[model samples]
Target: MIHDTNDAIPHQLIHDALERVISSREIVNSDRKKRFLQFIVKETLAGNADRIKAYTIAIDVFNRDSSFDPISDPVVRIEAGRLRRCLEHYYLAEGAADRLQIIIPKGSYVPQFVMREVAAPTLLRALDDDKQSTSERLPEIVPAEAEFSQAPVAATSSYQPPGTAPSRVPLLKRPRLLAGLCSLLAILTIALAGTTLFQRYQVSVSSRAVPSQVPTLMVLPFENDSSDPAQNMFAKGVTEEVIGALILFKNILVLGADTSFQFRTETALRDAVPNVPIDYVLKGSIDRTEGQIQVNAALLRAADHQYLWSGSFRKDFTSKSMLDLRRDIATQVALILVQPHGVIDKAELQNTVGRPSESLTSYECVLRTREYWRQPNAEMHKQVRTCLERAVRIDPDYADAWAALAFIYTDEARIDFNPSAERPDPTLTALEIARRAVALAPDSPLPLQALGIAHWLRREPALSIAAYEQARVLNPHDSDILADLGRAYSLTGDWEKGIPLIREAFDRNPAQPTWYRLFIALYHYVNGQYAEALAQAQKIGTPNLVYTHVVLAMIYGQTGDRDNADYEVDEILRLYPNFGDKAVFEFERRNIDPAIISRMLDGLRKAGLDMDPDREVANEKD
Candidate 1:
């Protein structure tokens, strides 16, 4: 017999059961019984003995919390249930012939060892009867020791009373137990408080992780400080030139003109600089007289909004020193921005100038090209090509100008605009120009990015991906590089890997193009998630997403919604009249669904537009 005597309760129960079962010697090594014993011991030591019978205890432990509620919290009820099955299994296999019996009676928590002479046949019959009745009486409680000796053969044998509780066990009195628990709780409380305070201090220190490299600066649109309104363009030109010069240095993330212009109308300095969460902002005002220009510039630390550096420059336009003065101002600003790292010497600053002239012609050309590219029509494409061509001519070795020219041609081929005006083979031309730019300066990632796009357009996806990966390694924080990488991956049908890269790029520059949304939509469409594709397409505003109409028409057609499909098809035709069978052939070559083709043709037919419906049927036949 085993009694609950704190620590001994666990050992005594197992020791007594093992001894009795071994004495029977019917089956010497029972793996199941050994496993049950080990399970009970492990549970008790783990402070989960009360939940021993619950099947979900292991799962609850794995979840690492008490989020689940069990029906019974009684330790006795749980142990009794487990013990009955354990003893039954042991008796049937290991204790068939033993006169001395071990009984873990139904619905009783503790084990009982009954020493009685009993025939094997009668005991087997009694065990069979108990098995039949036990399952139905799962909630029933049996009389403690009375049921143990009440077997038919046990009536003839002498019964021994249960043993007294063991003396070696120490009693944990209620008052002492409560006091120990309170002390433990208090210790945990103090430890947790100290740990939390330490963590908070670590976080505060880490929030300002010392920038890994030189701190960057964004020379925001300078205020026109001149009294004459006509001089405003000259002031703007000076600010733009400064931005252009600073961008040549590989160390800086000069917020481009597109981004800086967003802040032009923002009355407050804080509102204008939204996307760039930087450490500093360079604010300046340029005032000009008939023959002289005065520029006042101040660099303010973004963290505390305090001024870190300030200076003023005066130059006469007619004097030969004017160009020298502009270069001096640029050199000084670059030095101040990079000062936290180290002071840049005059010789090093002079070396940064790849082109010595302070002429605004190339700068103005870049600005015009930017505007034209934004419009992205046939005429705009031609204008951009012309501007970029002129820029390259002005500075023969300008890698940026070459890259811009390559990008214009790449865009023409990518969007299926007129390509002959730019080059007979725009994609190949773009690739050659991009490769030349990279050959000239392999460290620059911009040319490599353009090279990647050319490879993508050439249908060499794997090579494109490799080139983009190389670009990312060179400039990890470049948003344009990230976006191009995402597009390359998406085009190659690796949507899962592509979406996150695009998302990171979007987080870096939200106002760039809506290509991220378009890529996501295409991924969904190809994967047979039509509704999701439509939803993502809608998030990209309609005016900006011209290709969305084509995708929407395809999605609606495939889903068996003819009316909506025809509506989208009509809209596409209205917007782009030249969209014809070549477009359909391109769609088919890209593995667009046949049902979508039928819907597009149907919409075009209903809109009274002339199209060769036979072309789709012939492609299918071929």
Candidate 2:
């Protein structure tokens, strides 16, 4: 007997069943299906059920490489489904008489064995003795070939107990009748098979035909867990506030309040919208105690009920106004769950692995853009550029794709990300793309952000600030926009307003990128707070950007750390060999306030970077 605590089925029995099914004519024809079944069953038998995951199956059974990502490539999932149907057909036909049956349950790879009931031959033999009289008492007999012709055996194929055998009238003795029955069964079998094939074809087309779309989320109504009727109203208010805040994000699609409110529980939501493939659900409860509002919220992956993120927020309403408290909680929660590099973006990145650019949907292109931003580099930026270009070609109406592509164009022009590539004019190209994005999505914050960046690149600081401010108004929870607007303000020497805005953006987004700290560090350095500025600059790690090194060199130089300061200058020169000439040129062309530029240059000069135009020309001559 197998030593599995859950099942005591004999090991030999399972092995016999596996051999019978795999060697059967139904499974023997297809190598892929046969191997799929054999691999999972053997692994299960060997007590290696844990190794039967989709990733392992793709590698071991399908010859996929080590970089196989199950989410983007559905080969294993598709094969597992086909194998399951194949097993059903096998058991209903040739393996029906076997005492043990091997079955692979849905949504899992582990194989199981169940006992097949044996028929009592003696009961049929007794009825056959009195044929003439038994004919009247017996139910009409259906031929096994006719009965098992269908792929899925009908429920009417129920087991017959030993003593309750139906009387048998042999149709085989009437050769004409048997032949006609066989012909009819053959026609039915052909029609059923054709229908099944057609259905499978349709499923195959539907699975791959649809373009990848933005992940959708459904926010269930928050349950009121307090006795006060006012708390019930507050709960509903919070739910609506969250829904409103979530909808402001351009990437994710939040279900309408009407649709979301109809189902409060996850089970109820699934039962109601069986066909709606919601990717995530926001659910929680609200209660009030001692004049304080306590809200517990969790973000769940709708497919598996896995909690992707959860939070418990407590606010003292006695110290703050009720409306302010509600808005504050909703905005904070929304920012954490949907902002760039937040919970949803991180989860979506995992699903987008190994997907080729040409096959990406518009939404997937946008997701890929975020991946590039997470670790902004030249190689990944080119990949993202290709993806967005394809996305816009395939889905020209996707505003988010256009906006992301606009950023790529800006990067190419402003930073010379692809310095090898020559173009007539990328700055105007970026402006045109940004305008197109805004034309497509006038109300979306992402489009406005792209427009703002384009304007900034064009040296139109006022226009850039206007666009950033409008975008912030559109999506107040977007930390990137706030940060952009803050940087714009600071560049124009409105440090009073800019510093506070940047600080607020930082507080709102816990996952704000390392560069957001750059502005804060500069802010400290500008205020002559060397210790605080150095601490902040060190926290930024070694980012691959010339500005990061410049700021660090500035801070180190001010603190009289000559060694580290020289190292920072060397790193900057490594990135930009002719820093002396480039710095003077960039300072002349950039839209930054002249005073701020001069101050930053002063600090860089102190860090051992000879920022003299005269000496740079002399060195070239030498």
Candidate 3:
């Protein structure tokens, strides 16, 4: 082993060290690794660092075809990583006396040759930076400090021979003092050890215990590693793609870009996020060359800063390749989080397919519009419409955007009923857009689902059933598609078949939103399971909420529980006093089956629902 010295290392020494590593047994053992090492080093020394990229490495070193895709064929990256480990092994055992050290940091392909002492300092600083950054970012918990305030216990021994006599020695002698000091030192070390362990035990329990509910996540804005500011849009697009794909995780709640993008910096993120319990943080940087890109990401537990996963991906920089990158990364992150806990409930794990984006702007708009899903404000709804509208304007062939826009309009009709008679009907507009979506993407299942919704909303039950049945063939396990299909069957008065499919949807998605439980309640009501229907309806939150009260009132009324039904009506009236004068009854009459409408109206009438008394009487006559 070489000792530390103050003399400057020569340039020749670095080259010699590199040569030794490239020719060492570790490198020579693998044919692919030796060539990869030689190529990058030669490129770096020749001042062609920019050319030493994923595409170049794949073609020149690995003999890939001209149409080689760096995303699909990761041979170059795999070889580069292998070369790094080989160099580390060679230096540690065989080249220990070498004055210079060689290394390759992630996110770049250029080899770095430096004096041994200089390399040690940089690595030490990185460790220090990690420690400092961890404390600065996670404010709730910190490393325990060793306390030396308490005095150590005095030395004591219990041993005496039966025939032995005590020596005539004076107290506080030099020898006795030395023994006491040693004993006190040992006691102090043990005390510090125990204290630190106890503190770690407390932190471990608090931070590592997984909660009973589904995990929540927030995808923060990714940092751009490129020097050009123009690449910012690409970085943002990558972040959006990741969030969009992660939406398929039915058991996870992902925060939208609006809130996540607000915390652009680490300081802002840490300061703004402590109140909300986030289970993990997925963050990384994106670097791009002329025809290649590299992404480095780490998934860390928020509570204890434990790394669940960390990896780097280098790929060709086409938009389609980027889509593949996002899908792969999102799938890996979701599965890693769920695999250990045995919580993979949805069909997303089996469906890893993704379509290429014709226009990134349209794709970003589609991703941004999803943020307004749970939000009920008109302003948010307007934002969704504007984004999707502009998306289709920019890319007319964008099928997903058209389909999503269709769904938005259908929702506007269902949830945000307009009172102004002069405005165009939302259901009609949705039907037009849904038809356009189906025409554009005939092979895709999403447009078909949207078509089903539009047809059902337009009061064409048979057409809705046809569209839904086609969609079911394409994606049998999609919960949304199944739910829509079940609703169509209910409208057509096929309660037996519809009820099972809807129940299957709920079974496949244990952590679905509150509205899903309401759908189950509706299905159970149609199936004549009044008690189960009431129980499902009660799970929809406080009965004071309009939807919850409406579901409960109908269930209670049908079971001949008049007192409970009236109580639910009182809550509904308190929540929305104009229920009789509003569109709620109209929504039911238009969407429900004719055979079930009379029975439902009878229950509502007995519960004192004062909505359209004449219409109620007429329904009974039918």
What are the lDDT scores of the predictions, listed in order?
Answer: 0.52, 0.69, 0.58
User: Least accurate stretch of 10 residues (summed lDDT) in model 1?
Assistant: 152-161
Over the stretch 327-394, how does candidate 3's per-residue lDDT look in tens digits? 55555544444321213322222222242233235544444344344233455566556667766554
Tens-digit lDDT track of model 1 for 1-622: 3332243344554555566654332222333344444455455545665655434432332232354333323222333343454455445433545444455445432334444355444322432344245324421321112121212111110111113131221323222234356546655765877654322222212212112122445577878877877555555655655664555444434555434554452234345324334545777887777888888888776666777667888878643444445555665555444321212212123333443233334434444444444345666566656666665554434445566677788876677565664265677667666655554444456666776777677656655676677666554555567777887676555667787888877765444456457777767776678789878877755453347676676677667777786777677777676666566655453333455445445534544445665565334433
Report lDDT (Cα) of residue 584, candidate 2: 55
Residue 192 lDDT (model 2): 75
Ten-residue region with minimum lDDT total, candidate 2: 146-155
Clashes of each: 0, 0, 0
Predicted structure 2, TM vs. truth: 0.63
Regions more than 4 Å wrong, model 2? 1-212, 266-273, 317-320, 420-422, 614-622
Candidate order by TM-score, decreasing, is 2, 3, 1
- What are the clashing pairs of model 1? none
True lDDT of residue 390, candidate 1: 60
10 residues in a row with least lDDT, candidate 3: 146-155
